[model samples]
Target: MGQHTILLAEDDPDHQALILRAIEETGIPCRIDVVENGSELIDYLFAPPQSDDREGGGTPELILLDLGMPEMDGFQVLQVLRRVRDDGRSVLAPVVILTASDNADHAREAYRLGANSYVPKPTGFAELTEAVARIVKYWLVTNHGPPADRSDPQYPGVQSI
Candidate 1:
C-alpha cells in the first residue's frame, strides 16, 4: 500500500513540532503536509498540481484541523469545504478537529459544520503522542474510508440536514 497522506492545519510552531513528533512516533509511513493556518490550508488543497514533493496534489486521506487560526479560522475553512463538496467541486475528505480547546460549544460547532471528528489537544507530550498514535491507527489502519471517486454514491460527502 502507498503511504497515507495527512494535512495538518496548525499555526503554532511548538504544537506543530509536537504533533509531527507524535505522528512519527506512531511509526506509520505517512506523507504529512503542514499548513500554517486556514487560508494556507485552503490554498494547499485547491492549488494546481505543482512539480513538487506532493503526490500530484491529491486530496489528503485525513485533515487534522486546528480550530483557532488566523486569516480564516477552522470553521471558515469547514464552511468552504462544505460548499465545495455540495457543488461537487472537490472531494470532501474526513476532517478531524484537533484543537486545544475542550469547549463543548466548539466541539458542537465543529460537528455542526461537518467535522468528522473532534479531538481536544492533550496536555502532556506523552499523552499527546498516545492520542496521535491511536488516531493514526484508527483513521489510517482500521477505518474503511469512503470511495475516492466523488461520483460514487458511497462517497461520504458532507450533507446538511
Candidate 2:
C-alpha cells in the first residue's frame, strides 16, 4: 500500500460524507482519517490525541484541508505546521486545500502560505469522485512529496517548494 494516507479536515457533515465516499471509490488502500475541525487535524498530525488513544505508526502523508473551519481554520493550522517544520521539530507534509470557496485570492493566499494545491470542491458527486480518484492516482501513485532538504538534484520539476 502507498504510504500516503490522507487526513481530511472538514466541518460540513454532508460534504465530509461525500468526500469519504469519493476517496473510497478511488481504490487507493491508504488510510483516510477524518477530522471535524482544523484544531483536531493539528493534534492528530503533530501530537497524538493521547498515548493510549492513538497507537498509529506515524503521521499522515498528505492533508486535504478546508480553509474556513469553525475555530482554527486550515490557514492557521498550515501556519503552525510550517512553524513546527521550520523549527526542525518535524518534516513538512503536503497540504492540499479542498474547499467550496472559489475565490481566486483565497487560492493564491493558500499557495503562498504553503499549500501544495488548491482545488475548488466539485459540486456534483460524479465530478467530485473523478477528482478524488485522479488526485489519489497522481499524489499517491505518480507524484512524490518530500521535505525540501533531501530531494535528489537530478529530479526535474522538483524543488524545495
Candidate 3:
C-alpha cells in the first residue's frame, strides 16, 4: 500500500552492509535508515538536538536492533523504547532484535524488555537473505502496526509510509 521505513541500529560496518543487502534482496519497498550505536539510535528515534534532522522522518514502523553495542546497548535502548511506548509517544514501532548472540539469556531479556522478535544473525549470505525475506514478509506484509497520522504537519516521516 505505502512505503515502509525501517530503522536499523548496528555497530559493525561489515554487518551493516550485509544486513542492508539482505533487506534490499527482500524487495519490501522500505527505506532503511541506519545508526551505528545505541546512543545514536536513541537520538535518532527521540530527535535529540543533534539528530533532529532524522532522514527517515519521525519514528520508523519497524526497528532492527543489535544487542551488543559500545554505549547504551540494545537492552538500554529497549528499556527507553518501552518507556516511550508506555508514555504513549509516537514511537509505537515494533523492535526486532537482530543479533549475533546465541545466548538464551540475551533473548529472554530482549523479550522481557519488549522486543517483538529475536532473530539471530545468520553467518552465510544465503541464510541472511532467507531470514530477511521471512522477516520482511512477516512484519511488513502480514503484521498490522500503528496507523500513521498523515494529518500531522509536524510529522512528515510517516507520510512516506
Highest lDDT against the true fold, candidate: 1
lDDT of 2 by residue, 1-161 (tens): 34456888999999888888888877777777788888888777655345555444355667889999998998898788777767666665578898999899999889888788899888888998887777767766777776434343232112234
Off by over 4 Å in 2: 1-4, 55-57, 147-161
Candidate 2's displacement at residue 75, Å, is 1.3
Ranking by TM-score: 3, 1, 2
Residue 63 shift from truth in candidate 2, angstroms = 0.6
Name the lDDT of candidate 2.
Answer: 0.75
TM-score of 2: 0.84
lDDT of 1 by residue, 1-161 (tens): 57888899999999999999999988889889899899888777765444565544555788999999999999999999888877866556689999999999999989998899999999998998899888888898888775555333222233222
Candidate 1 to truth, TM: 0.86
- The lDDT, on a scale of 0 to 1, for candidate 3 is 0.80
Local error of candidate 1 at 50, Å? 5.8
Better model by TM-score: candidate 1 vs candidate 2: 1
RMSD of 3: 3.5
lDDT values, one for every candidate: 0.82, 0.75, 0.80
Model 3 CA lDDT for position 157 = 28
